[model samples]
Target: MQEKFVINIGRQIGSGGRTVGELIARRLGVKLYDKELINLAAEESGLSPEIFEKADEKESKGLFPTLMGYLRAPFAGDDGGCTNVLSSEALFQIQSDVIRSVAARESCIFVGRCADYILREHPRAVSVFITADDACRIRRIRNRSGCTEEQARATMARIDAKRAAYYNYFSSRTWGVASTYHLCLNSSVLGEEGSADLILEFAARKLNTKF
Candidate 1:
């Protein structure tokens, strides 16, 4: 067997999660995969990249409430006699196949796309979730994307909503709910390098690998 560890990251947007994931991958000398998974999925599934991008990290249902997300199932029945909506099995299959292909090829760090859930069966796997305070996340998004604070906040809301629904729909676990991951780190507290160092140290202890 190839003796290597796989680190899968599920993170909130603007949490400096991607930067931390990249840093950990570099520290561990492992390949980092994020948006590349989209390309890989597209190629594997013969689906256009645009289609996958639209569905990526989003629930099949557009029904998540705009308020505090109490999701009243008001329109739950007889919408074209459809009973099962929000099904993501097709997307899940694509992600699962792509993740397995990557894992078979080499050990690496995979960020988002429910990679932890996709690769749940792998033996040498560590799953992490990263998040930050609303204010911190909004600031980071505004700075990175050059959006106004309101725009940043709105974008965060939409993206996080989609991610939550998609993750919950597929994984049978709540997103960022603390119980779904082996490590849950607040990037606001640790910052980028500090969070990276914490993950590196944890990995070192678990895998007996040197930084």
Candidate 2:
């Protein structure tokens, strides 16, 4: 398709959502932004990338308290006030700007970090939610993370909770809800490649273009 469009994927932990996103981007010949977004946001905000990495997809303890801290001083005071004190909300805002900038410039696939919500008003954006059965997710997580089944399950719960909390805190929509996304797919049923193919077809149909 000559007309550029953005794909925003929201996925549960260990559901092969990233794999599907990478495959779709490869098939469409566009850049995929996941961890790359942190670098872009860090560059734009002039804050240490490590901070963004640590705060990625995590909700702040309390927005009011964090804003009060920011108001108290321009930077977050820690270790004699040398570090930048950007709250989770500040980091999200910076990343949202980067997402908007990228979408404005070209076609790309954005995985998580609420890209769907950030680009809600974009004329040619496709939002997808990728999920899988818990058993499937646990097995996938165990294989990828080299952890036991119990550890995998724990990891999944922890990460998904953080993502849900972050998404709910920042956006008006709820995370992993099918209605919040234009399309929802079960990655385990279709597998990564199949899911990517489906997304490409869906995107083409949504944009009324041939892929």
Candidate 3:
């Protein structure tokens, strides 16, 4: 019997993480789940796509004070505020459930969204953290988003901050710290294609261990 493997990728923004994940999925003949998870969560929660988009892999920083109106405290609020909280929580539940469903369905590559924590019990799962040099990441961001280096750097920091906050809020493990992942790779070291090949080779060997 051929044993299945799950690859959960945690990556920095503009670090070629998604590109490598897609290539790894293609080479391994597995499904790739990233943005598609958002759609699935929205459908499951019966929420508007915009709500999910706003809450996607993000931490709720609490509601606005002025928006709460006469509502005194955070807990004391109108139906709209309550509804917003409920919808956001519902979306998160759906996302977590969908992630579990995909892991159970088959071997697949999951990019981000605390997938490593989601599949921690899976026997053949490999958790990886992808990052690159600041220069490389800034350049990539600039090219992709047409922003200046300073803007790109700020954007990168902002997005990564959100991701870190979300992950930390949801999971006990820390993000980007060496102890959190089984393996950490710098995409700039080998380029995107080369990094993909290296990861494939490593995963293949790990998968073959039971053979």
- Top model number, TM-score: 2
lDDT string, candidate 1, 1-211, tens digits: 4486788888999999999989988877789998888889878865556656767888866532233111234344445343322224565677679988998779899998888887888877888899999999999998888999999989998999989998898888899987888889999998999999898788667666665
Candidate ranking (lDDT, best to worst): 2, 3, 1
Model 1, residue 135: what's the lDDT? 94
* lDDT score at residue 32, model 3, on the 0-100 scale: 93
Q: lDDT: which is higher, 1 or 2?
A: 2
lDDT of each: 0.80, 0.88, 0.81
Q: What is the C-alpha lDDT profile of model 2 across 1-211, one tens digit per residue?
A: 3877999999999889999999998888899999999999889876678878988888776632353444356455565444446677777888999999999999999999999999999999999999999998998888887899889988999999999998998996899999999999998888898999899999999999987
Candidate 3 yields a Cα-based lDDT of 0.81
Q: Give the candidate order by descending TM-score.
A: 2, 3, 1
Per-candidate TM equals 0.83, 0.91, 0.85
The per-residue C-alpha lDDT of model 1 at residue 201 equals 82
**Better lDDT candidate (2, 3):** 2
Q: What is the lDDT of residue 5 in candidate 1?
A: 76
- Stretches off by above 4 angstroms in model 2 are 63-81
Model 3 alpha-carbon miss at residue 28, Å: 1.3
TM value for model 3: 0.85
Off by over 4 Å in 1: 62-88
Q: Residue by residue across 1-211, what tens digits does model 3's lDDT show? A: 4666789999999999999999998877889999999888767755556766777778645511223222233345355454433434445666889898888878899999989987898888989899999999998999998999899989999999989987887786798997998889999999999988888877778667531
